[model samples]
Structures are given as structure tokens and as C-alpha cells.
Target: MDILDWIQNWFKSNCDGDWEHGDGIQITTLDNPGWDVEIDISKTSIASMNLDWILNENSKQDWYGVKIENQKFNAAGDSGKLIFLLGLFKEMIEKIENNTIG
Candidate 1:
């Protein structure tokens, strides 16, 4: 699977509708070639978390982040979601670097 395909699978696996529908995360492709990824997540209190990644050409990887809204729960709520996002992104990057996809 390529990076994009990997990402799609990762997100599909983690999708959960039971959680408090805070806000659906919106992912956008940056103007740059297909490497840049932008994430806009809605948090509580009408606030939002925005992140951008500039994937390295060599590693086929990048860094991204998000701030948990409300943050009533610990990482379980916020961290878990953020970590899942990062993990999926990392997994996708690795798949691309290794050229491993089904």
C-alpha cells in the first residue's frame, strides 16, 4: 500500500461514532505536491485544533499534532485520538518508505 492507501485503512479502522461527536476532522491537501497534509479538528468550546505536516522526501514521513478539546478525560479521550492519528500517519509513512502495500 502507498502512503495514501495506508492512511485510508488506518482511519477506517479507528473510526468510532459512539464518541461524543465533538467535530469531524477535516483533512486537506496542501498546495505543495501531495506531500503536505493539513488537519483541522474541532474541539469543545467552539475551539479547534489545526496542524500541518511537511513530509520529508527521504523518509516519506512528517510530524503532526492536535490539542484535545474540553480535555475532560485524560489521554484516553484526547491523547488517544491524537496518538491514533499520529500513529496512523507514521504507519502510512512507513508503508511508503518500505514500499509495502497490498
Candidate 2:
């Protein structure tokens, strides 16, 4: 499936309550000639955990232009940013499936 479709399906199956009820997940283009992906984790099972701690402790791989704040994560870069976001998203979904997120 396409990345967008896969993302929608993932949220549909894994997200609790109405996933689209708020600023849940946002994917948009950036003026810096790149893509941006924002994910709001506050509504997820990992809501209670520290966002910074989660990134530092779990995502060891470096994401240069990514930002995590208040249960939200935003990644922006060139065209490659899409791939990076996809990888991060997949890993998070796996963690969720494995009950690894607190």
C-alpha cells in the first residue's frame, strides 16, 4: 500500500477513540523545500511518558531536524524527510504493538 494509505490504516486500527477528532496526525509540505510530519501522542497509550525521554531512550538513530515536544513529534527535512518519518512511524507502531511504550 502507499505510504499515506498505510498511515491512515495504521491510525484507524491502532488509534483509540476518534483518531481524527483533534490535531492527531498532520502531514504537510514545508516552505523550506521539504515535508513535515507531526504526530500527537497525547491520545495514545504512551501519553503519560515523557516525549523527550522516549526519543532519547528509544530512538537512538539520529534525526537531525526532528523535534519532540509535549507529546508531539515533528520531523522536517528535504525529500528524504518522508522516508525518515516513515521509518519512525513504523518503529513506533511496532513498539505500540509490542506494548513497549508506557
Candidate 3:
């Protein structure tokens, strides 16, 4: 499935009425010509999960970073990395689900 579709499903799955009311996903464009994504994981199965910050910097225009913090999944990268960043979130959830990450 497409990353955005998968993410939408994931978000919908977590929406138990109240959870979606005050907490949800946020995507924005950074002033530095990058994308920012934040998805709330509070009150969900991954609430207590931890993900150390991951950064990949190949060039001024090719870079991305991902991490979990304060019950939210955070990712930021160059404009070209928007989809890649979302894919990372999908992978993170899959790895954690498969017991491949601790």
C-alpha cells in the first residue's frame, strides 16, 4: 500500500473517538526547504516504544531524520524525502510489530 494510505489506516485504527479529537498527525513545510511530520502515538500500543534518533545526511538536499519522542513519531527531511520519511515510520511500526526492534 502507499505510505500515505497505510498511515491513514494506522491513524484511523487508533482513533477511538477521543484520541482523534485532541491528538493526531501533523505535517508541515520547514523554512529550511524540508518536510516535517509528527504523528501522535499516545494512548496506543506503541505509546511506550522508544526509537533512537536516526539521521542520514548525504548532501545539502538529500537528508532525513527520524525519532520517537513524547508519544509522537517525528521525522524531518529535505523536500524530496517526504515519502521516504513516511516510509520510515511504516517500517518502524512494522519492525516493532514483528519483534525485530527493541
- Give candidates' CA RMSD values in order: 12.4, 5.3, 1.3
Give the C-alpha miss distance for residue 61 in model 2, angstroms.
Answer: 19
Comparing 1 with 2 on lDDT, the higher-scoring candidate is 2
Which model, 1 or 2, shows the larger TM-score?
2
Error of 1 at 2 (Å): 1.1
Candidate 2, 1-102: lDDT as tens digits: 767777778678656667568788888986646677888777666555444423322232333366567777666656555876766766776697698866
Query: Ten-residue segment with the worst summed lDDT in candidate 3?
Result: 42-51
Ranking by lDDT: 3, 2, 1
lDDT of 1 by residue, 2-84 (tens): 55566566456545763225423344343322222223222222233222333222322333333333422111112114445
Using TM-score, give the best candidate's number: 3
All candidates' lDDT scores? 0.37, 0.66, 0.87
- Number of the top candidate by lDDT? 3
- Estimate TM-scores for all models: 0.29, 0.65, 0.90
How big is the positional error of residue 91 in model 2, measured in Å on the Cα after superposition?
A: 0.7
TM-score-better candidate, 1 vs 3: 3
Model 1 steric clash total: 2
